[model samples]
Target: MDLSGENFRIMILYDFKSNLTVQKSFVRLRTAFEDEAPCKTAICNCFAEYKSGRINLSNEFRDGRPSTAVNIDGVRRMIETDRHVTYHEIQTSLGIGMN
Candidate 1:
């Protein structure tokens, strides 16, 4: 496989083993793609963060307004959507609001 593919595979394994929190995972993703251009890095980080379950990407908004102070909408949405979902589920979901 090419270097890029090999790197991604390594990242996936590392991500799975680390069991890192959303913020930490996001930081790692940023570091991973730091060499890329700004726009590419931002997109990569956003997608990576989502895939790592460190953040939530849902349609539900908080109180019909975006919370500018703290970002918990992702957790709130996940909890509301399925209260039975475990803490790990929230952690593994594609959103970062989980605690």
Candidate 2:
């Protein structure tokens, strides 16, 4: 899996396996990484997941629509048909948004 920030997670996992408390792990990370360390909440969440049997550090899918699904041809046609259309109009026509 991607090891980008997994190093920190591995540190957490190691501390967890070594029977350290969450606060201890958080302190260890802060000592090791200082400002570069993930937030305390991040440490807690990652540690919680690992405790719940999630061992890997890859990204998990969260609840949300994909950020962008624009149809280029559809947008081109809409713009060609009406040059005055606003961005919201195009978004409405394409049916893609946070809602």
Candidate 3:
């Protein structure tokens, strides 16, 4: 079964609504998706959110800065300027934390 994206999430929601335990749901998902299945922690998180009355199935946006704010042009320029520059040096110069 190619239960990769929306179908996978929808299955989780269905299991939640069907009163299936998180462990049971996780097992089913792992059996269906094999290596493509999400981790157990992810299943737990989804079940927790459902129990908390969350129904939306998509990722919600956070208000803080995006995870990746570094500009590609800036990185390219830096690499051009210092061919041997290490990632640590680039991070230090850009004032960005470990990505």
Candidate 4:
């Protein structure tokens, strides 16, 4: 099963409070999740960041490319060009994946 947001936060907190080495923490977390925990690399990275005070248990907003698929002008132009245009057609013509 996928870890819920609450469980992920709890895992972070557990890592912090337990003060276990990354490997040990990963093993414990894996056991907690019935061997379906997140990858070791991800767990280690997050633990390192958290120990270094770079991140907290709360979710942070990540900066990345803003979405362009929902452009108003593009949608308006598509509608003007064809009232009965299917969403698939718009996606294909605009080369935008469903987000």
- lDDT (10s digit) by residue, model 2, range 23-65: 9988887887787877888878877877888788544543235
Error of 1 at 1 (Å): 16
Over the stretch 1-99, how does candidate 3's per-residue lDDT look in tens digits? 455455666788999999999899989988877888878887787788778887666556422367767767877899999899899988888876784
Per-residue CA lDDT of model 4 for 1-98, tens digit only, reads 67665467567667866887778877887787865676777677777667767655554542246545466689789999899999898888877677
What would the TM-score be for candidate 1 when compared with the true structure? 0.27
Report how far residue 24 has shifted in candidate 4, in Å: 0.9
Q: Cα RMSD for candidate 4?
A: 7.6
RMSD of 1: 16.4
Kindly state the number of residue pairs that clash in model 2: 0
> How do the predictions measure up, each by TM-score?
0.27, 0.59, 0.58, 0.50
Best by lDDT: 3
Off by over 4 Å in 1: 1-3, 35-99
Tens-digit lDDT track of model 1 for 1-99 = 223433443454465456665455546655756543124343355446556565433324312235544347877888899989897777677544543
Better of 1 and 4 by TM-score: 4
TM-score of 2: 0.59
All candidates in order of TM-score, best leading: 2, 3, 4, 1
Which wins on lDDT, candidate 1 or candidate 2? Answer: 2
Off by more than 4 A, model 4: 60-99
Q: List clashing residue pairs in candidate 1.
A: 53-92, 53-93, 54-95, 54-96, 55-94, 55-95, 55-96, 56-95, 56-96
